[model samples]
Target: MVAAFNRFRLFHWLLAAFFLLAYLTGDGGELLHVWLGYGLIVLLALRVLLAPTKPRGFPSLAPARREWRKPTWAGVGKWLTFSTLVSVTLASVLGLGMVDNGEVVAAALPSVSIDVFGTRNWLGGLGDLENVHEFFANLALWMVGLHIAYILLFRSKSVMPMLRGLSPQGPGSAPKGRNHRQAPAWPALQVSSKVQETPDSCSFELTPPAGEAARFAGKPGQFLTLQVPCAEQPMARCYSLSRLPQPGQPLRITVKRVAGGRVSNWLVDNLQVGDSIQAMPPAGAFTLERTDADLLLLGAGSGITPLLAILQAALLHGEGQICLVYANRDEVSVIFAGELATLQQRYPQRLQVVHWLDRRDGQLNVPALVQAVQDWQQAECYICGPQPFSELAGQALADVAVPEQRIHRERYSGVEPAVAPPSPGRPSRVQVALNGQRHTLDVQPGEVLQDALDKAGLETPSACRSGVCAVCKCRVTVGSATMRSNQALSDRQVAQGWVLACQAEPDSAQLQVEY
Candidate 1:
């Protein structure tokens, strides 16, 4: 079902086939051999001349200076690739010079002859050139074999990109006007300030470089994806914005250390002021939907970060009353404690703040949550916390007969679970309408919908391939689908048929979707 064939891939396949055939038929002096040589010459020329015109077409055969110093596996691969290209080119040129018959392929085309070490005869004096050609040809073949083995053994995922001209987890170069949102550019934002909110938690203020603040502007409750440089590879982690968005102000994110959380621990213990980190633009569907509605916000532990932004935004822009139920293990574990107290004092009549410390009040269970929110049952509820607390709050709301559509929950984990590919079976049919084009795809059971579209060469916008970013959201128009996990979409959005493609799995045999 993977069908990402394109002109570049076609050229690559043809050139590979021609090179293999020509190498095998070396020195045959037959019409087929001569024609294959000519084909290789033409294909190689086209590839070299047209590479600059294609998107990221030029291969980085040579490693960068830093890469040479570091000597990573990537740099070694580049060296091997460069060696293969050089060997192939040299062999092809030698074969052209070794051609001695003018009428081998085309009578009108004159045969190419070179006097190497005073040689003119094909077998008598030019035997040395043939030996050299054979050396380079064999070297090219060996280099190619090594490259294939390296890919199969170490980077099996890379083969798909070569065959399809697109990476499985990367954004593709879709045609313009195709309704595909371009991938977010990761720009390095400097850390302007840092604050230790709690013993195991800290808040950092990140400011974009000069003239780029507008790109980071985001609605309250949205989150940013940070690319953390780990020891082995760069890790992408999502952190909710903890402060209200303002022009020319640095964005704020609170990080709470989680046991064995690599990114979180690194960020808390290592990140310093004046350092820079790459970040994607803010994205999430947890923003306040209606500022005018009475709001009941529920949060526990570090989950209060995003809810604080929402509460602040609501208090600043809306006339409706707002109440926040914040739970924590103890008084010292509360993040933004001072700020919340200050806001409560300033807006005493409009904002109600309730803090529940488990050390004093025990855990916030379903019965307790129901009792706490009984007075605010008519308010629109927004909950963000650990899975257990969020689920308990949701259950309490359901017990109170609050409409499901009015309750929204934001749930995410420090570590994402591994998603296995679907078991082999008959795939369901999916009819997708994107950018005025209709296409059909066969989706395997339990397969993520966004991945299916990617294999089919559709370049839909996506990031965080986990369901946290909501960058790959789409609407199902015909059949039904279920999400494996959802941290982005609100209950209202889900009810309205919006599904995050990265998390959606087909629930019916036939379905229709539009982006």
Candidate 2:
């Protein structure tokens, strides 16, 4: 569900009411019909004119390319919306041209005359203007009827957004920071055990320090950001949890050594059992959206970490079929090969694992990927891998006509390029409102808003601080700010003053934000 502001809602209701009244008046009330048509034209013109300035108030009515490529009920609704807009505009224009005498409504308002194309003869035998006008009017009415039916049948939750300023099923409907509040800012956890999963990868079992077990809980597929103490400075890096999250069980994270990766190399070489490290609570948006639906899991190399978690959880709690397509360079580099084999043997009837080794199969191509998951095209799909592999899997799924909404992708690599560092200057002042409490602080140059709030003990919710996840979103209520990078926010959200606190930096002398 998507939320609509008050202005958009007003325009929506007024347009619907006026169109219905005008269509019903039909040849009986000429005066009322003409006036209603005039009102609609003005409303359409205003909507178009204000769209650039008020983006959130007037969403794009055009059907997206994906809607045309794939035929879903939601796509059909979008096409109907576009059709209705076109038909109504043509009807209004033809109606205006059909009006011959400039004095039709001049008696009521002597200063106004709406004779654009004067007489019906101006059409030059193309067709009767009144008939063409009536045809388009009826077509618009039909398209509107279909649109309403589509909403009531397939998108009932969408109606609330236009009726009120809130969407009952939207992500924003959840209480902000509720999940982050469950854990401390950074809790120390001791490594209980370590296992070499592959030649270059290892898994660590992290046990929460005494009295902090409850703060370490998380859903399957979530990740923990560990503060790695390198020689120069402590760097924060996120590692996916490798096993199902269960109470009283130690949290497990698998780290694969990457060439020139400082944090990954340090953890794989220097970290040992009994060593303690500061870790942020588990956070991510990659968790399963539905447990009952069959799942298609795709992964390559160490990207199998999160998918293993999801597969374990789904097999334990869900009664749905599962298919996993895992790719790796060869048998020696396949992480969790033994564990996957054991699980496949245990749940042979419900789970299927297909390993694609480049040594034998050559590189995984789009056609091969499509063939592997052809039977599960309708299942919920999750893809996690390097950027190239993820893109290939997504293209294969799209080729098979999977609905875009059902396919989720998580990139295991590619941190955005760093923004220019702030110049040396006096620190900026910041005022923050959180959970009904207010606090003031001075934010140093280049300091992120989320870091400042966390240092002040404000507990700002955040996941994927690079801006891929919008868990730390907040509104700028007073002054201006700029984001170093943003991949989660929509254009409408940006226009409405929403910013991702994890990437936001103060651009003025003073700034205020509410969470």
Candidate 3:
């Protein structure tokens, strides 16, 4: 996601730089103008080749849009960008033609003789090439001015991406990890220990084998995507680290059986200590960082895992007024029940535990939860759980006028990617570039790029194939691919042609992606 933003920023600035230099230099700066001409031609060619894959940030030139009487601001901006690109390209071509005449540019700059192979065959050897070049060059200049003015008008919100290659999202949809792009590669680690938290719930502690424990540092509330061996194929599942990280601590993840969950069920029933599993380094953005604010952690089922970690970290730092509203089906189903009770007894003055049970409480209701927490609006609420539970909790907090920025959440799964419409039976030719090598593979129209890469014997780092982790994001340099959904990318990133390979499928016949 971020890669696309950087590409756009780089391409945009390069075009502007060349255009300005070429215009100021004119033929008087013959050598400068000549090189600028070459640069602009290359830049425009790349832009045009990649235009089809551009985001829907601007209005389409298609006849289909003619029927719509109203035009969007986005469409207007798109039209402006497209117009400038076209004008500049035409100007560059005309300039090259004028250069081929050699006599005109050479005369203007007496100090330098501009020499290049003459190709008068282009544009039917137009006699008014210089005039045509000047007209479009001036036209492009005006459009560039307008574009700069537009950017200035919305610089605070839009320009930051150009500078930092990042655009902020609403706090409700916080991106996963603290710049997870730099995270280490997945490492093979053996499970060191396992403990039964409750019936149907188990916690596995992973450590680097031998003296490699130094390689396994992780923060609380982060998660490791473990590659587990199944009977047929390997299954990847993300589980939150349930314990706070210490110098010598083993990374722990808690898993509870879900009725139809293949990964969770397999993990709870089959995973054992001493078994080996491949694990991506710990990464996630939903961790407790602000200690001054009163903390409220809301979670249900295994969602309590990360919240539990945050709670322990907060308590260790002596943060006061911390509250936990943990919900479950029954007391018997609660994970870490004993540890939570011990924590409550230890910090009876500052910590509060309110348990909601389906058997007695008839499901956790929003109004009741709000009522139970007297300082609900004052607390920074960290929530995790099933989709329905999270949605309910978020709405409840919002209903009470709690600031959206104060609420953080992590979803293990459930976001359907923003993908292309189904075109069943169609085949796509995908070219993948990874670690300086390129490979080609045929993907079914609806198949994700990662699957095709795997078939071609290439490894593309990924976690949470649903697109939340963003570890699989790759830049599409040619053709187009669409993500089914995205929580990782900013709008600017998507505009620049970044797609989550695990969640993206090609919409064009041939696509080129780089990792």
Best by TM-score: 1
Q: What TM-score does candidate 1 reach?
A: 0.61
Candidate 2: where are CA atoms >4 Å away? 1-184, 414-417, 420-471, 475-499, 504-514
Q: How many backbone clashes does candidate 1 have?
A: 0
- lDDT digits (tens) for residues 378-482 of candidate 2: 788999888899899999999999887778766477353386676798777999887787889888888888888878877777754666446678999888888
- Give the TM-scores of the predictions, in the order they appear: 0.61, 0.56, 0.55
Give one digit per residue, the lDDT tens place, for model 1 in 151-206.
78877876766666553331211223555545556789999999999999999999
Whole-model alpha-carbon lDDT for candidate 1: 0.77
The model with the greater TM-score, 1 or 2, is 1
- The clash numbers for all candidates, in the given order, read 0, 0, 10
- For model 3, the stretches where C-alpha displacement exceeds 4 angstroms are 1-186, 414-445, 451-469, 475-499, 506-515
| lDDT of candidate model 2 versus the reference | 0.77
lDDT of 3 by residue, 247-357 (tens): 776788998887777777888788788887887666666767554346889899999999988998877753347889989999999999999999999978778998999
- Weakest 10 consecutive residues, lDDT, candidate 1? 167-176
* Candidate 1 segments whose C-alpha is farther than 4 A from its true place: 1-176, 179-182, 231-233, 290-293
